[model samples]
Target chain A: MKKSLEGRVAIVTGGGGGIGGEVSKWLAKEGAAVVVNDVGSDLSGGGFSSTPADGIVSEIIGSGGDAVANYDSVAQPDGAKRIVNAAMSMFGRLDIVCHAAGIVRDRMVFNMLEEEWDDVINVHLYGALNIVAEAVPIMKSQSYGRIILFSSVSALGNLGQCNYSAAKGGQIGIVQGLADELKVDNITINAVFPGADTRMTEGMSSTARAYIEQWGVSAESSDAQGIRSSVRNAPKVAYLCTEAAANITGQVIGVFGPPMTVYSQRVLMRKLYKSNAWQFDDLDFAIGSSLNRNIPESRLGGKYEQR
Target chain B: MGDRFRGKVALVTGEDHDLIKEISTLFASEGAAIVANCSHSEWVERMVSEINAVDGVAKVGHFDLTSMADAESLLNFTVDSFGKVDVFVSGIEIRDGGSVLDSVPEKWDEIIRPVMKNVFATTKYVSAHMRTQNSGQIVNIIRDKKIHHDISVTNSIITEAIIGFTRTTALDMEKYGVGCNAVISDHARNAALVSAYICSNLVTPGISSIFRVDEQEVSLYSVPAIERGIYSSDIFSVDELNYLVPKYLFDGEELS
Candidate 1:
């Protein structure tokens, strides 16, 4: 593959470990000046350090690639500006922003405290906004940029993740909204739902993890090509932060274990209408005879316990 | 409709054919004391009279749900009569009919406000009531087919926004023995009947989805032509509505 992003200045907000770390390394190997950012957050959004980010920066530099470590948090506006500044000050330009910064605070929605919701949304959704806001003006001035936001299948109203789901769902709106606003400026923004295991995901969705553990399976059960196959998609994720992907914008791509698919957003399935505004009683009866009475049995909601 | 809801109280909106004659009547037949609420329409008195004739308990009311005062009044009426609203089936209004760019502020406000604010106000007041008993279901009825005929841009936005709203509210109310979900009416009629029962019978751990009432389910009941769905496309005609209403609702019922 070509070093398509060569000479491009890029920032990977959670570049310290797992998905973000690999993405940062790949971007650097492809010849971009990488700013590997991480606040070294423990899984629950507490406890931070600069070591993880520094370590990734070291790996990139050691491999003869240009890189630097940024320890600022992306969850705050000022922290986001500082992260962007790290790229311009170090590499003299800003081009790619791979927003991989996130935190996990899983609980049944009812069990979640206010702070839990705030912390998770702050990192995943608001953090995405802060960095994009700091970068968009510069990207517009230079007339070129690529933005990639994180989303997941859980965004379809998964249990025990109301805060995470809502924030991720909101990201879809931002990707669509920003893609339109920046289309004329040659800046492309898209959301990627990566289906891979990382440090942060190690203990989440415990029921599934317990099942996998029972089978003695982990993220790298069958490593090959001198790197974990599950993480091989890091290169594909890096590709979105390159000029080669300029035409792909305002879309949600599902990057599963191997085969990737583009998702259709908010499609209309069917319709029942009237020439005049609907009256309350007439609508109820019409809905029963039409919309409700028509659909097949198994395709409806609440098939299994929603919680 | 089943006797499972015989002693329950159901508050349904829309006074026309589907919301009243079908969904609401179906509920009353099964024993739910009905609160057939509607905006002042010429057809409401007749709808209520038919319900009373069948020995089904029902009370009719006129309130523009967009206004908080009106929504509260409607809720108050239900409380005064039935002692509590076990199920609140909300019917949305759709007015804007133009391209997104052509839609002015008033048009957007007019079309979107009533649909969403009704949800906010009704759920707010009803949720307070359900909290006292620690049990209830909020079924938001959305117009799935309205824009299918005329590229109703504003309606599309409002509907999609409500889905987002429903998911968040589901999260908020699940703790209080209250479950929130939505049903997509292929049209405005029979809108509340099926969904109201679906909402009233929503078991613990409700399925959160947009149930599109298909042609097959419509054929099971003897609804008029206007009460059935027609379209620019038959994309989901083959797909079942179980993703919203669940399979139990259609058990032993014809899907053809």
Candidate 2:
């Protein structure tokens, strides 16, 4: 295939390893000047180091691709601005942004602390906005940009991940609103919900792991078999960051081993009985009818299984 | 001759009698197994039987755009018959004619209930199977203009809603390789239904001027029997729609 992103400038947050590292490499290999921004924090979104980011930057430079490392946390507005500035200062312009920096605080709603929610939201949702606000003005000046935000299947409402879900869900809303505002400016914004073997989900509860394993799936750490699956699911993130997706905006696509499904949050089938005035009995009937209409053997319920 | 979708199952809906029939027959000729054909009227049944008689695989299914249950069943029947749904085409028109004040609530619902709502229902359900298989294409036939000059404001609103829904779903499902796009057709074929209230009446002098008709004298000097004006055809050809639909879906690539 032709180099889809030749001469493009990309900024990938959390570019040390996992999805961010792979995305950073892919963009560089496709001829992009990639700015690898990572604070080297763990999956919970804390800590800092230049090792991981710098290592990836060296790897790209060694391979004759343009890249630089920036140790900046995406959680703060100033940190986000500095990352964008690094991209412009190093590459001269920014054309693509893959906001893959995020953290997971796995706690059920009852046990979820306020700090847990705030931290997750700060790094994923607000961090996304901070970066976008700084990047969009430059993109608007150029009149060409592609933004790939990371959402999760968890946003479909995962258990023991209320904070993560809230942050990821908020990312979807932000993408939709921003896409509408930027459509006339020739900028397209989209999100990818990837299913791959990453450091984040490696420690799933035995019960959940068992269920996934029973489906003939193993943890992505399982030798070559697991690595192959991870690679297959990873390219989609790169594809979304390419120029061919110009007409596509405000979308959330799921990327698994081989299957890629377009998930939709749609209005359920509604039932309205003919009436100008309503009563308790009418309310009961309407609720019952709405439930029945909504709950058929449809994909909405299938794609999102309730725990 | 090159049947990329050969041995695959395809489903089509709506009421472009000539266009749907032709497209369905073409897919069958290209080796696709026509799983189910649905329409809002009985006339579609007659067309289905004609395709079946020619040994082009097909089954008739009830489809009323107003009913989501029927829309769901249309998809279920396709999976039940062929065990998979490889392609889906929606070619229905559900908009009623009238200006803002003249258009009633019931009429607005009549138009939107099928075209917009039904398409949403189908995309939501059919995509479930495609996602599992990691492959599928959905083509929705939309009009070039949201309002056809004479229709009410509701038409534009409904059209916008569907387009928004399509864009959102397209992004969400890219990982599964499922593609979604709408084909925008021109206005000639459906003009009679929208002429009076939407477009100015094709006859009245100033009203004719609104549609850019030239001035003509009606007097004793005029001939007793004279042709008034020419009628324009706004309906797009099947070839044009087919080409455009895939272009939108694959981002200008011929490959599905």
Candidate 3:
């Protein structure tokens, strides 16, 4: 097979963490010169250091792949702009933008703090907006690009992930809305609901980890097997980055462990189409008699019957 | 009579099901050694007795799929007895079924944890062994969506994970000549039979999918066994298997 991305230049945000780090390496291996961007902040989005990005860059270079390190927070316009600028200045061209950087602040909806919510929003959603916004102009000028945003399964509404879910879900909307706008420009954008056993999961308590770990699969094993391990989610990201995936865009792909699921845009199911306006009694009768038989209950609504 | 899986060794989980037992019996009847894995000794004894009567090679492995310890024990017992596991059949059945309402935090863990452990532990050890040989096939059985009602969120999650793992494992093991895939069906017999073909030399992993086809008997197989030089089937077929087997294994003899 051809080196699908040979001679391309790519930028991967949060290139220091688990999924992002692997993606950086995989893209570089595909012959793309990478700008490994990581503002090493702890889970709550605190301290920033250059080491995360720097370490990945060095590994790439050591492995005979070209890479440059960018230590910029995606939360700030200046930082986002510089990161994009570095991609062009250092590599002389840019083709892929992978945004996998973010932090988590978990709490119940009622008990969640304003700042906590704001902090997560800034990093996950706004940060994605800032970084991708900056990359858009550069990609447009080139007429060829791939942008992969990091969404989460929480977008489907996890119990204590309102802030994270909101931000990630918005990322999906961004992918959907911008997809058509960029299609004429020959650019493809998509979202990934990634599951990797990376350090980012340090937030989970030991008891929870122990419970989950019984069946938990790490990205490292996936990478090592050269298969779709949770972390091997990187390879799919790399495949999307390549020209081989020219027709795929405005889509959502999920990676947890063994499976890579292509999620459909929501469609109406078991609808009761009406010829004209109906009385409340007619609607109620239809709903009970034909429309809602054994329909799935809402996850958020927390309703369950024997079915 | 044809020995389709001669000299092969198959390790099958889910000993409680009669379908899986018959599947094991078919593999053994075709001359491959069988490892019948179960959680209870009584089921194992019942399974082994029938195999013994047929002059078929078989062994009883009683271990929990949930524990990492037990997973290791299962792998070790299989390897220690059979020398290696060429095909892994994840036919596990957990009857703790319910809907999303049962998808509570505590309940979610209760349901997903054991299945998760079963998948990972098996993959970790068995894939490691297969990687050394650079050749193997893994088949997982999931409930088919055609009859997918009354399903719990817990089983739904488990099925999704198995699928992801299977696809990725297929990708991971491709270079090493190892293939992994899964089948989705309500009837264990159909699933177990399709998996038997997959584990046998007749079927190899070229296309990965959650197989949802009917598993009719050989007499009921309506599709022509051979079509043109392509060899196709509306349902699974041993003839279609020829296309997927490793090229070197054929020694340049074209099946067509």
List ranges where model 3 is wrong by over 4 Å.
A202-230, A297-307, B1-256
lDDT of every model, 2 decimals: 0.64, 0.58, 0.63
Task: Put down candidate 1 lDDT per residue, A98-213, tens digits, no spaces.
Answer: 99888888765434555676687678866876788788888888999999887764554545666676667656656764565677899998887664566656655632332223
Tens digit of lDDT per residue, candidate 2, span A88-169?
Answer: 9888899998998888877533234546756876787667767887788899899999998887655543446545654675
User: How far is A2's C-alpha from truth in model 3 (Å)?
Assistant: 5.2
Task: Output the better candidate (1/3) by TM-score.
Answer: 1
DockQ (C-alpha) of model 3? 0.01
Pick out the ten consecutive residues of candidate 3 chain B with the lowest summed lDDT: B219-228
Model 2: lDDT equals 0.58
C-alpha positional error of residue B72 in candidate 3 after TM-score superposition, expressed in Å? 55
Which is better, 1 or 2, measured by lDDT? 1
Q: Candidate 3: which pairs clash?
A: A219-A231, A226-B172, A227-B172, A228-B168, A258-B164, A258-B165, A259-B164, A259-B165, B98-B152
Off by over 4 Å in 1: A203-230, A277-307, B1-135, B139-179, B182-205, B211-256
> Candidate 1 has what TM-score?
0.63
**For model 3, how big is the iRMS in angstroms?**
20.3
Q: Give the DockQ (2 decimals) of all models.
A: 0.07, 0.01, 0.01
Please identify which of the two predictions, 1 or 2, would achieve the higher TM-score against the true structure.
1
Off by over 4 Å in 2: A205-224, A227-229, A297-307, B1-256
Worst 10 residues of 3 chain A by lDDT: A298-307
